[model samples]
Target: MLEKVIRSPLILIVSLFLMTIMLWSVYYGAFSNVFESVLLFVLIIALSTFLFLILFHNKRNPERKISWKSWTPYELKEEDEGQQWVTYRATRKVYIFFYFAIPAGLMVVAVFRHIEFMPLVVLFVLGTTQYGIYWHESRKYLNDREEV
Candidate 1:
C-alpha cells in the first residue's frame, strides 16, 4: 500500500486540491481555526512523506534517477523507446487539451468576474484536468501493452 501510494499520481492530485482549498480559505478569510489547522497539518505531513519516499526510491534504484529528475503531470517511467513514445503521445494530448482548456477557463473566469477566487479555481481545475488526462493516457497505453 505504501509503495502504491508513493507511485500513484493520486497523492499529487490530493495535495494540490488541499493546497487550493487552503489558499482559497486564506484569501477569503473563511478559514476555521480548528479545521484549517488540521488540514494544514495533514497536507504538510503527506507532502513531506511523499518527498521522502521519492528520494528513498531514487536511492534504492539509481537507474530510475532520470525518471525522478523531470517529475511533472505527464511524467512516466521511460525505461525504453516504447515507454518514451508513450510519454510523448501522452504529452502531446495534454498540450492539445490545454490549447482549448485555457481559453474556456479564461472565459469562465471572465463570466464569473465577481468571484474574486475564480482565477484560482480555474487554475485548480486546469491543473487537475491535465494530470487526469496524462494518467488516463498512460494507463490506456499500459493496458494495451499488457494485453498484447
Candidate 2:
C-alpha cells in the first residue's frame, strides 16, 4: 500500500542513520584508542541496557498502543488473507536473513579477523533493522485499528 511504502522506508532510513551515527562514534572516538575503546564499550553496554529496558517496558505495557489518528488519508485497511500470506512469507525471509544470516556471517568475519568492534557494528545494524521493523508493524497495526 502507499502508506506502508511511504512510512516503512522512512522508518528504515531513520534507523539506518541512527545506527550509522553510533557506529561512527565507536570507530572514530572509542575504537581508535585504548581509553576510547573502554569508554565506547561502557557507553555501548549502557545504551544497550537502556534500550532493552525501554523495549521491555513497551512490550509489558499493552495499553499504550501506537497512534494512527495523526496519519493522513487513513485509507489503508487490514491486510486480507492472501496479502497476509505474502506478508508472512516476506517476514520469514527478512527474519532469516537479517536476524540469522547476517549476524552469523558477521560472527565468522569477526572471529577470523580477530577484530572486536566488527561484531558490535553488525549487532548495532541488526538492532536498528529490528527496531525499524517493529516500528513499521506497530504503525500498520495502529492504522488498521483506526480504520476499523
Query: In terms of TM-score, which candidate is strongest?
Result: 1
Query: Which residue pairs in model 2 clash with each other?
Result: none
Error of 1 at 14 (Å): 0.0
Worst 10 residues of 2 by lDDT: 69-78
Q: Model 2 over residues 1-148: C-alpha lDDT tens digits?
A: 3234433445445545555556666565643567556655666675575456545544665564223435431223234764455456445645765857586866676676766466656666666666556456655755675699
Off by over 4 Å in 2: 1-6, 23-77, 98-103, 124-148
Please give each candidate's TM-score. Answer: 0.83, 0.40
In the predicted model 1, the residue pairs found to clash are none
Give the per-residue Cα lDDT of candidate 2 at 61: 55
RMSD of 2: 10.3
Compute the lDDT for candidate 1.
0.82
In order, the Cα lDDT scores of the candidates are 0.82, 0.54
- Give the CA lDDT, 0 to 100, for residue 21 in model 2: 52
